[model samples]
Target: MPPTSPSRCRSDGVHLVLPIVERSSKEPSAHEPWYCIIFSHRLTSSPVESIQSTFSPLSGLINGIFFTVIQINTDVRSAAALLDQFYEKRRILIVSTPDISNQYYKLQNIMVQRAGCGLDLRQVTVIELLGLPPREVGRIKENRLSSEVIEELRQAMRISQAYFTMVLVDKQGMDRERYIDPVTSDELFSYIDTYMLSTEERERMENNRDHCD
Candidate 1:
């Protein structure tokens, strides 16, 4: 049979082209190798060269086919603009590191994950900027921040992607604390209650704490 043509489709401003090579029934292993290519309008013609690749030795194949996720951000906001949304509403915890596997990053994640309720009551939002050159803006118990926002944040914070740094920004959009090492959730909560929270907020937090307990 003639080789199957590549199928093309577009959705939500994203363009995807999938090329499939059928495996022979008698000699499936001998079939020609094919690639699944994805084309995004936001990306250059050759995004594959830039997109990260992960291969699994156990499966002896790429874990997933090549496809650039279309992150839809209608109105991309600057770092300051993005952070402004949380001001007077939620305290921001910005964590920047070279990789997600960093010891301090993992420790911080565990600590935050354990104190979800406390963080919520304190109106704390954690933003993780993991990996550099093309850093990924992630959210802990919230929505992911866009790359544009992350880039602006990188500039605003003057973060050194080569090392681990965690900054605590209050609801007023001011950096209140900076940590080079992992901080305990209890320590974080104590600091926020002591310095960051208003009297009314503290009272509310106390009431919420009682119910949570």
Candidate 2:
């Protein structure tokens, strides 16, 4: 079964519509969340380099989790464009060094794939980083960013030629979590899904309270 649209869809757009079965049949529905997982720089071009999306099929636990992990090759301008679009919208970003071989990035690859993982991708944009030479960035390369934005990120994230890091940017586009060299996969996973997710929710709850007050 594919997504059905009540109205016409654009040729260039992606439309996936599924019935909300768990929700009440009498009540109106809202939009489903979309998750974007960015790959900051050149991939190793190895099969193992990918974030494995496979999950256990036990008891249809996956559908309860409704997020998709989209790996965008750097292509800096497009990435910059995407960031601009998402920053004001519902998105969370995960930034990491270019080395996908790093333990942290791989953990995110797993975290992004889980159902009921407790993070909403539609409201979050994930950013991963690389250590590429500025001269290597070009229109043709998929893993590149605007020079100005790159400089901004380099300064904000304290990127260097020496360390592998992962920086988590919250919905406000503020840096939430930063992990540098020698961080283990267990530590990385906990930092992101546990602490970060809880902090994000806590802020959201606070905002909702503020709004109602």
Candidate 3:
């Protein structure tokens, strides 16, 4: 089979082509070996259109080949734009990042996605100390901050603090299944409520309620 033309290849999609080679025995009397080639691609389209287009070429390739794996990658900006085009007013954006700078960039993209026409930015929450290992978690619990990491964390926090309403969540006991332990959540929230507030800031925010109304 010939390679797919670049013009036919969709920009919003990926194309994968696998070639199969058959091995033959050294003896001239030996039969020729036959093998199967697999090709797969993921395209960005509406759910219905994606499904319909995916199977058409696949069906022509094999008589009874079963699809074992299918993976889809979506452009976050495009997805958000599509939602906005449909007049989605409010959206809950949950972004996770190992670095604070990436988190801020993701937040900015969300903001850009919802630009214009009464799209209010609400609920900007930040989760610090993400992806901490178990030993690191123990050290944090014991109030021993690594000097090197403390400086890094401080720098990250300084960069991200302005854009987000920061919340420090203790990531102890959080694994693949459980995101944050209930005890950790409670403790973190309590600490925030207790120490993260200035009386003047609180009063100012309370006074601004009339303006909001």
Candidate 4:
């Protein structure tokens, strides 16, 4: 296989593979660094050596980029369990659209790009589900969810893939806010502060609101 060719390994009905992203000049200003997600799901006596030998040629390339695997099992229970990992740890902001060219998605991406500090401060993980399957899943920063997982999220939220939709899931893994149109950073921050944050978090947010911008 070529150095950049994605090696596919299956686990619980999901495939973990590397992504080859082709960007265009008309695309929004989201810089995605090259990443590799390589691992074997089935445990074997020599799994480590097997994986190392398979991608040995690409070792240098892999080391040059940031990489981690996000696997999604299509089973209903597994999907829920996958999301459970984020429960009580991070708030989820899911942004989905049929395509990235949607005006609402573009605006949301720009807003999110500018509000990284605020998102980090609030422990929010932005998951962008752009484009249709069997196309590759989209990545916003380091979060690249599988198409199956994205579909699960869409179905869970009852969001139509034909339109732009944004859903905010709080730390407790509950849907707190939904928007069909683009939302501003100030609005998101205010909502989180009012409804999701604890008293201490709210006070800290008040003190650091200016820094988040």
Candidate 5:
């Protein structure tokens, strides 16, 4: 029909195409394609990466920094929530196994790793969660948890001395990630840099954005 329809598609099939235009994300008539230049500076070593294990003050952001180290034979959920009420800083709860009666080799391992020294001590809270059916030492958040909770969590976490199990949580008192049998200080520090520092930076960015907003 009509030379095989030399026109654009339409309901009536009678519209002819006239003009078309194109656009790009570049300057018009530019001789060279646009390029991105990144200005960078020589990265200086931070206090935490000292050559002789110097004291680090949590990257010198110690004004509002805090840390808690807990060692216990309680349920994970109950103990975690219970230990968190001690302070308003970053908290680390090391769930102990049933045989965590007297031998504290596990805790010793952590201290030897530069985790509970210098500025880390100021930010960390060390508590021993010994005895079966972990119990709260004192009233926290105005209420003490039941023994059932501690028992349930103990079975779930299955913390023991034979093998190692560690958790790396965020500053907001949330479970970010967990570790088991970390062999070296680098592995431990790697997660701290990745999760801890990043979380702190993200929080700082959000606060700045809110202030600007």
Candidate 6:
């Protein structure tokens, strides 16, 4: 027991041990790993074509187009509805043209002016003058000849007076009575200022105008 007791004494003792593994301090945790995913769709060259192509996939991601027209009242709702319907179907073409006046060519001048600012006038093609009274259509041709109307048209269209005069001559053979008077610079400026103002401000101005009057 004296000689064997040397090894027997160590066997009765208990020992505590722990295991360790080396890891990078910069490594993300299993619950906090970095990850990213991306998705994309191709588009066509033409804006109209691109709109049509990407519409299905991108409709949910984009606000649909808005169009304003001047004289063609019927076309406005119809066009808007068409665009809405197309967008709902995930397909669309945002073609917009000003409403052509069927009542008086005087209104058409205003439409032309607005159209010039908002649209490519050259792309406009004459379709059948559907549902318009013959007299109304005739009025458009007749108004093109009037010196006063021509001048008003030029001013509103923001083009040279001479250009409108020539356009009138080319469109209509003879002159007619001027329907709209020439707007003064003050009047024009007032209109522009009103246009630039917010809806509340415009309403206030309108109320003030009515009260003053």
Q: Provide the lowest-lDDT 10-residue window in model 6.
A: 11-20
Question: How do the predictions measure up, each by TM-score?
Answer: 0.61, 0.40, 0.18, 0.61, 0.36, 0.21
Best by lDDT: 4
76-161 per-residue lDDT for model 5 (tens digits):
34655544443244444443333344344365456434543321322223333334433322111122335655444344445443
What candidate 3 gets wrong by more than 4 Å, as runs, is 1-151, 154-195, 210-213
Overall local distance difference test of candidate 5: 0.33
Please give the CA lDDT of all the candidate structures: 0.58, 0.39, 0.27, 0.60, 0.33, 0.23
Model 6, span 30-66: residue lDDT tens: 2221111001111113323322333331123212322
Candidate 1 stretches with Cα past 4 Å from truth are: 1-75, 140-142
lDDT of 2 by residue, 1-213 (tens): 111322211111111212222333343222232223221122233212122232221111122332233323333443354455455433444444455565755665565444112233223434445446654232211233556666556665465644556565664566666656444444544565455555645554343322211
> lDDT tens digits, residues 1-213, model 4?
222333322221111233333443332223332322432122233332334444432433232322233322222333476567567666789888888888888999999988766776676767777887788465544545556666777777677878898999987878888999998999998898778988866765566556533
**For model 1, how does the per-residue alpha-carbon lDDT over 1-213 read when each residue is reduced to its tens digit?**
212431222111122222234544332121222222222123333323332343221122223333322112213457776666566766778888888889988988788777765665676767788887654655432345567877778778777778889899987888899998999988988898999988877766665565334
Model 4 earns a TM-score of 0.61
Give the candidate order by descending lDDT. Answer: 4, 1, 2, 5, 3, 6
User: Model 5 Cα displacement at 22 (Å)?
Assistant: 78
Clashes of 6: 1
Q: By summed lDDT, which 10 consecutive residues of candidate 1 come out lowest?
A: 6-15
Q: Residue 56's C-alpha lDDT in candidate 3?
A: 40
> What lDDT score is found at residue 179 in candidate 3?
23
Question: Tell me, what's the RMSD of every candidate?
Answer: 16.7, 14.7, 20.9, 12.6, 25.8, 31.5
